[model samples]
Target: MQLLILLQLTIYFALVLSIRPRQCPKGLNDANTPRCVAMDGISDVEKNECRSAKHCCIGRNGYCYALPRKVVPTIDPDKTNEEMLSDAKDIMRSIKGGARFLNIGPFPSALLPYGGEDPYPGFPRLPAFVCHKRPRFPDNCDMEDKKALRYTRNPPLNIPYCIRIPCDPDLPELDESRTKCREMPGCFFDVQLRDYRKKFGHSVMAGVPVCQLAIRNKVFLEEARKVKDKTGEWTPYLNECLLDTFDEIIRTNHEGCKTLEMLEYFKHKPKIAGWKGIKEYDCYLIAGCWMTKKCYYPVDVNNVTVSASPTEHDDKIPSALYYGRPPCQKFDDKNAKSAIESYHSCLVSGCKLDKHAQNSYYNYLFDFGKSMDPSDHWVFWRLVESGKYGAHNLDEYNLLPKHDVTVTPFSLVFNYPAKPGESNLIDELLRPGSSSLLDMIKTGSGLQVPPAHQNIRDRFLEDLQGIQTPCSTTFTSFGARPCGPPRYKPTGVPNHCPYRPIEDKDLKPLRGSFEGCCDITLCYHPKEEIPNARSGAATYYSTWSYWTECSATCGKGNKKRWRRCIGMDQSQCTGRTTENESCEIVPCSSWNKWSRWSKCSLTCNSGVSTRTRTCKPIGGFCPGPDEEIESCNSEKCKIDRLFGPWSEWKGSCNPCGKSIYRSRECEATTCNDDDLYEIQQCPTGCGTWSSWSPFGPCTWDFFFRTCQKTRTRVCNGKNGRPTECQGNSVDVAYCIC
Candidate 1:
């Protein structure tokens, strides 16, 4: 049973190792390690613990890696729940306070005024409802006493109020047809007669009686002309007579006659049968209609009395009369005693007339006089407005002062005074002052005159000249410098040649000149040959030779050899050839004929035969080919082991022995076939040193007057001796020759 239990434990251990903790049951991993699992399956207490641990862990990690235990204290469940709750409440309060400090409260309500009915009745009054106090009145109340309260306020009092009440519907409506009158009503004549008497007074009735006669004449003439045949000339003649009579009557009586004539004429005339005549005789109607029709009544007055009061002055006399031939009344009366008398009386008495009365009298005259001349009314009306007497019969009013008048381009004439406080009219036909001949001369002569009398022509010309200079003025003619004849020398002129002399202290010289003469020609003189001080003497000759020697010896081509030859062989030996008598050619079998003869043999006798042979004639003779010979077998001679210690001779020689020659001490020479010398052992007199004969010594002269020897001396070197030892007295020495 124990083995089975052990076996089961072993199996469980293996399974745990094989499966990862993530695949294991919850909380089965090491207790020290945090197990991430679903919170839903855990108890509330466990979840709470886990959350607290998580918060603590997060807080510790955030605070620079402090352990969770150091950052948060362990919970003590033994403590009362109230303590925990109180701590929690404190934390919540801190969070809430922080939120409040950040102004994170619910968004503030909009600042707009609230929209709702007012809680209290009329709490805030509208601007229109506010009342303003009335203005104060004066203590005496003068306006009130006169019932002139209307002017007390800034704008007048609204006394009548002028309220527009709607029209009354209950009352009978007025007939729109009655608004316009086409014909006279039955009561119109009576109304007009009563109104005429009220307006003009009883004296007007006197004119009315005359006016009726004129009316009858006018009617007869009109009817007579209409009824009569076109052939009868009497009718026209009678018509003229009747018209002239009517005009006479109208001239005598003005307003009252004109009114009555107009009424009767319109009443009787066939043309005006349907149209209503004007009952109230307005002066405008008579003036306009009579002037248009050209039917002047005889009794029309040119000037009537414009009285102040009609009732008191009904019998007053007229100021003037209309009288001319028959029908047309003269604007100025030539023969009318009453009209003349009335005008004289008006001039004598300075009487004032009412405006309406004056207007009525003028209208009558205008109607009567305008028929003769259409412009008469316009001229007369202007004169009346000017307060001047315009009628021919009346005295002149003369209201305007006397003056000379100036007319502007606008046709408005200003009355300038010839004397102060006086004026006059200028005629329209006159020319403007600018173009007037009189004005032109007065201005052009340049005469000083009064301030007001300066003519426009002079002023205009002066202004133009002030702005523009004379035509002759130019840049050169003005005070400016001229572009004159070319200047002989530079001169200081403004913007022309304005250079000033530069002081030496202020000016810097060019480079490389102490005395400021940097020009090469000015500073340096031309080169000339230098003279020799010791001329034509031995010292001069020797110096010249020395310089020439250096030039020749140091020149290219065997410089060292040439330098060695200096003073040693001032005369170089030239090679000469004479036929050598001792150089005899004998047959090889008889070569031993001469005393110092060398044997030339073709073959030897058998078994070393000893014989002192003379020059013999052998059957055949032989000669060897040419060979090379060198004195010193240096690299220049192209012979190996021919120089240095193994040399046959050690000094220079005139003629070398055999195929050998001296190069220098401790050196040798090589032989060639064609060489003159044959190969032989050097004699006892020749030293065993190399480099003999042509290879006497290696010496180089570099630069001028300097000689160098390459080989070291084996013995004490002597001058003028070859580099070999011949006897005890003559040791070979390598000297630079």
Candidate 2:
């Protein structure tokens, strides 16, 4: 029984050894020789040789050993439940403050007014509504007065007819419709009258009625013609008839200044129109229509009067009809304020009064107040506001000593005179006696003279050498600087007369008209001629030029000829300034010779030596070799042993159950193809089993048992299959009987 138990134990141990997973040797793998090797202090060749010997290699700082068992802790759901519940309680614990308390609130309401409402009643109240003010015109203004502010003039007056019918017996009767324009006749009349005003209006200052002059030209010519036919006292009758005809025509065809023709006709009547010679009518023609109250015309007196109460002294009058001072200027020391009031009353009455009288009054006042003090500039209604009279000023205080300074007058000094050539008025008024003529002359000199005056001056100064100097082209009638070439004749005589002779050095003497012969040598000189410019052409000087360096160093290089204007003068250099051409530089390529051969790599046969040469002038290719090589070895090298010391012996195989074996490790280099370790057979015991007994008597109730037998064999670490074991055994199984 003991032997049988020992045999069973032996077989069990062998089965455990055979079935367990195989392990590698210290310095090698299962397919290699040694079981393990040192991780550090080993050369690559040593490591490789160790691996070839079937050894397991340890990594740096680690020993080759079996892997540890995982031993993972298995979780029991019942044991962990309490701990998990505790963790959940910690996570769900309430914070110091509730979530509702920590949350932000909605935005605050906007600021409100004192009563929590707006001051204005409307919605979307705009800034303009709160701050802006509407504009309004002045009170006491009539519809016409208000409308006139924006009223523009009518289209240009087109009067396609003769202003005067020819005084001829063969002439046809005057066709009023064809000869007169009744539509806006005042506008047409103003235009016709203005033309004559420009030409002959100056006669008014001399007390010459324009109407008389108008007839004199035609009547005088007719009278001269009739003289050949022996007419007697016909001139006076002809004049009376013409005057009557004129007065009737004006009444039929016009209004406003058009009535000036009537005034002229009346003033020139056979017995009523002359003041010693001709009546210097103290009135001017107003340029536009006038609206106002009618003047009171006394029947016996036949004159306009603003009087409220008349006394007997006012009735004592001359038999000859006489016009009084214009209502605007009728004011005296006693009546100044009352007269002004009366004038304003008339201005605002809105009645269509005779514009002729209003214009006459305005003209008289304007003309008379011109020479007064600067503050009195507004004493009269400025003619420029002919259509706008009384539109703005309605107050009693503004009536006198007025200062409507913006009004521009042609012949009157409305404000202090401005600088010469200025179109607008300035604040500086000329003093009564300060250099009036000299100022006039100076101011005139700044303006361009009329063409006739210029021609006259040019002719008188023929003896001088240049044309007129440039002067301003602006002039007022009162202040004109007539042009003059020179104020002197060739002999230097100062003559202030028209059409005098001028002696030229090379031409015939020419006659010229001038205001006065003033010495003009200072005003003109011979024109200077430019040194090199004839007829204003620019002059230039010569330039210098040179060729610059080539643009390239090898092959074809561009060379440029650069030219610069000499003396910084460019006008003379007009053609191409620079030029380019191709050029070449000599390419002298060179290289250093090869250096002496270096020492051989070996002292014996078959070694090699090398030599090298370098190219000079680095850019271009070199013509010789840069390196050379030659054999240098002189002898062969001998081989040496490369195997390491043998490792410690490993365990002998299965000593209790089979014959044992032992082994040790050594390193094997590439130089030799041999095993890295040696093995030796070890001696050990092999137990045997006895044969089993045959079945005795069969038990009636239980199956009968049979005996088994076993045998032992040397383990050569080979032939471990069941068939081999069966072949080696004397007995293999037992039977049950």
Top-lDDT candidate index: 2
Give me the displacement of residue 368 in model 1, in angstroms: 18
Tell me how candidate 2 scores on lDDT.
0.28
Superposition error at 214 for model 2 (Å): 49
Score residue 658 of candidate 1 by CA lDDT. 23
Q: How far is 54's C-alpha from truth in model 1 (Å)?
A: 99
Residue 306, model 1: lDDT of 20
Q: For every model shown, what is its TM-score relative to the native structure? A: 0.11, 0.13
Task: Report every candidate's CA lDDT.
Answer: 0.24, 0.28
**Per-residue accuracy of model 1 over 547-666 as CA lDDT, tens digit each:** 111222212321111111111122332322111112223223324432432232211121111233333354222243222222221223223333222225443442332234433221
Cα error, candidate 1, residue 95 (Å): 99
What digit string (tens of lDDT, one per residue) describes model 2 on residues 164-199? 112221322211221232121121122323233355
RMSD in Å for candidate 2, one decimal? 74.4
